[model samples]
Target: MKLSAHVEKVPLIHPFHITGYTFTHNDLLVVKLQDGTHVGVGEALGVYYKHDTPYTMLEQVEALRPTLEHGITRKELLELLPPGGARHAIDAALWDLEAKQRDMPVWQLAGMEPPRPLLTTFTLGADEPEVMATEARGFEGVRAIKLKLTDDALNAERVRAVRAACPDAWMMIDANQGFTRETLASVLPAFVEARVAVVEQPFPVGKEDWLDGLDCPIPIALDESIQDHRDLGLAVGRAQVINIKLDKCGGLTEALILAHKAQEMGFKLMVGNMGGSSWSMAPGFVIGSLCTVVDLDGPIYLSADRTPAVSYHDGHIWCPETVWGGPVAA
Candidate 1:
């Protein structure tokens, strides 16, 4: 097998803002593995909050050159790389390579039922309340809208602005580990008042315990708090929703098992992304089929997407097998 990867800096249409970060472009790690005549590709945007950059992700993948060249399986990969973007890119490439080798699709390999178009949430970055409201209105009645929020006192006002702009669209918010116990409490009423569907990562990662006995009506979803399946135990009594991101869990291999086990453990599932290109969102789209909430809109943020891309249509994200993890590579 021949392993090669590069950093592709894809510019974003707009500067993307969350609680602790701002991005003008996504520096993606695109990994390609060649076995015989077949080539497989995977894209990854490393976890930003962890200070993961394309160079760091590339270094991690390069460190596993010997193992990958010698041929590694997804299950074996779990033992090798701790969960993060490097492992995710490699694992996804391996899955794609194996799928092509077997002349089948990844969903079939995973024994999942055939996938269909799923309603995916479009995100509005943290901005002036009116700016967010304007962006929310631009979605033109999107089925779901996910808002980026901060710890500021104006969070409730931001929620209300978007709600007023798109009264019919279902709403969710992600503070991206921005809030404290006190600020969260102050904002909880606004979330409920605006009828926000879920409040994601409102409190910082280690502050999940603050949720204990807090009277909140909105479902609390965990993002930064839950990485791979091993972290599920932390959310058992703390959060109602578990968000799975490929970059955090390793890749589709772990994400599939994580989602299944999370569901069995009685948590609502969410599949999210790290703002890679459409290729990065492809694998997540498969997991999205099983999730109650989907936020795989990374490609839409990109200034340009690769050919055979995952597309958004009719307020849904559609990933054709040709986009990834099939006999034909994207």
Candidate 2:
């Protein structure tokens, strides 16, 4: 087997605004593993928020090439690479390769019931109220909306504007750890007022204890706070949900573990992404089967994406065989 990677910069259809900055493009790490005539593909987006870049992923992959080139399985690959973009790209490609090799679909390989169409949440990035509302209005079949938030007074105004524009759409919000303890208390009423279903990681990481003593009007979902199993114990009775990203939790190997652990603790589950094409979204689609909310809209944001884009119709996304390596019954 031969291991290789390349980066592709795919521009977003519009500016993606967050608390402190705007992202115009996604830097994707595309990986390929070839053995003779068969080749498998995978993708990952270097997330700046996590200090992951194309260069950093490349460095890590290069150091592990000796191992990957010598016939590595997806399970072994997880042990070799740390949980992040690089491992995610490699792990996903291996799953694709294995499915092709076995002449069976990924869902079958995992012993999962075939995937039905999935209802995914559309995200409204943190921005000026009116602009965010305008953007929200343009999308069709968006039953659920996840609004981005900041630690500012205007947070309520933004939520209100989006709610007004999307009155029938269910709402959730992610602060991406932008809030302080004081600000969180102040915004709790607004979140409840807006009827926001889940408030995600409002405060910074490692502040899990702050959430333990207080009562929130809305349930909190852990994103940055729940990276691995080590953090799951502290999350007991602390958070109501855990947002599991395959990349953030290393890959499906650990993500599956984290999901079950969070479930045993009675926390709702949400499966999210790092933003990329269908190639990147496929792995998370498996995890979404067990989640309350799915955010696999990464490919939809791109101006162009890999062929056979995941079919998201009427707010429901269906993963296709061309992208997944084998046909699956719905």
Candidate 3:
């Protein structure tokens, strides 16, 4: 086996702004593994909030190259690194490589059902109420829209605008840890009025206890608060959904475990991304099959994607047959 890695800066169709940061481009670390004539690829976007960058991921991958080249099993790989972008890249590549080696898809290898087209939520980044409404109006055939919000005075106004623009679409909100207890309390009425189905990470991580006994109109999802299985207890009664991102919890390997545990605990599942191109979204598409709400729109935000990209239609994304982990003819 051989190991190599490189970086690619993927430009976004529009500027993406969350709580404290804005992104015009995503710097991704792409890893490749080769064994004779067969090759597998994976991508990781080590975003700043996660305390990781493309450079750090590349360094981590290079440091593990010796053990990887010499040969390492997937089980061993998990123990070799902690959960994060670097592990996600290597783990995804291993899954791809193993699937190709067996002449089967990664889904089959993982005992998962075949992939199907899923309705993905298009994102409306934080902006003026009118601008967000205009953006919402611009999208056609969208079934769900995820609205990014801040603790600003216009939070309710933004949701109202989007809901007015896309009256028929399901609305979700993500505060990205931008809200406080008081702010969230003040916004609950508006969320109920706007018919927002889900609200993600309204308050910062440590402040999750603020929701311990409070009645929330919509299902509150924990993103930053839940990293892996260990954080499951933190959201037991506080949040109704857990947003699983491969980059945050390592990769598909750990994500599957987290998903199962989340289900066992009676928590709804949501698979999301940190934002990247198609390569970064491929593994997430598989995870989406096991989720209730799918948000694999990372590639949709990119200006360009790899050839033979994941297909999108009527707000639903179809996993490309040519990409990693396929339902190839048996």
Candidate 4:
């Protein structure tokens, strides 16, 4: 087998601002693995928050070239690298390569049911209340909307504006670890009143224990707080849901394990993304089959998508038949 990677800086349709930072373009690391005539592809967005960059991923992949060339298995890859963007890219590529070799979809290889079109939540980045409201109005027919909030004074105002504009839409809030304890306490009631279904990572990562005895009307979903299976125990009594991102947890293998573990511990599951084109979102879509809330809208944020892109319509994303994991056509 042979491995190679390159970074593609694709522009976003708009400046995407969350709680911590803004993205004008997504710097994606595209990894390719080849065995004779067959080629497999994977994508990763090594964002600064995770301390991953395309160069870092490339170095990691290059370091493991010997093992990869000697033909490493998915399980072995998990131990070969720690969880993050680098492992995610190689793991996804291995899955793709295996699927191509077997002439089947990756879901089948993973013993999962066939992928189905799932309703996904579109995101409204942190912005002015009116700006968020306008964006919400544009997605009037979307079934669910995920609002990005911050520790700003107008956090409630932004939620209210979106709720008013799309009164019937199911709303979820992602603070991206922006709120302080005091702010979180103050915002809880407003969130419940606005009919927000879930509040994600309101408190910073290290402050997860703060939720231990606090009464939160709406469920809190942890993103940064929960990385792998080890963190599941820490969130048991605190958060009701865990947002699983393939990039954060490394790859689909660990994600599957974490999802099952989270389920066993009586927690609802959500599958999110790190923002890229369809190549980046394909794996998340496969994992979305087992999740309660699916937020695989990364491709929708891009100015353009990869060829044979995953199909999305009416707020639902269809599994790609042309690439990655899905049942092959007869």
The global C-alpha lDDT for each of the candidates, from Candidate 1 onward, is 0.89, 0.82, 0.88, 0.86
- Whole-model lDDT, model 4: 0.86
Return the clash pairs for model 3, or none: none
Q: What is the C-alpha RMSD of each candidate to the true structure, in Å?
A: 1.4, 2.0, 1.4, 1.5
lDDT of 3 by residue, 18-126 (tens): 8898889889999989998778788998646778888898999999999999988878877998888999999988888887777888878888888889999999899
Between prediction 1 and prediction 4, the one with superior TM-score is 1
Model 4, residue 136: C-alpha shift (Å): 1.4
Candidate 3 local Cα displacement, residue 29, angstroms:
0.6
Candidate 4 local lDDT, residue 186: 84
* Candidate 1 residue runs with Cα over 4 Å from true position: none
Off by over 4 Å in 4: 326-330
Write the number of the candidate with greater TM-score, choosing between 2 and 3.
3
Q: What tens-digit string does per-residue lDDT give for candidate 1 at 1-330? A: 999999988899999888767899989999999998998898898887887777899999999899889988889999998888998999889888888999999888888889999899999999999999999888744889999998677899999999999888888999998887788888888888899999898777787788888777889999999998988998988899999999998899999989989999999999999898778988898788889999988988889998888878878988988889887644
Better of 2 and 3 by lDDT: 3
Q: What is the lDDT of residue 9 in candidate 3?
A: 86
Clashes per candidate, residues 3 or more apart or on different chains: 0, 1, 0, 0
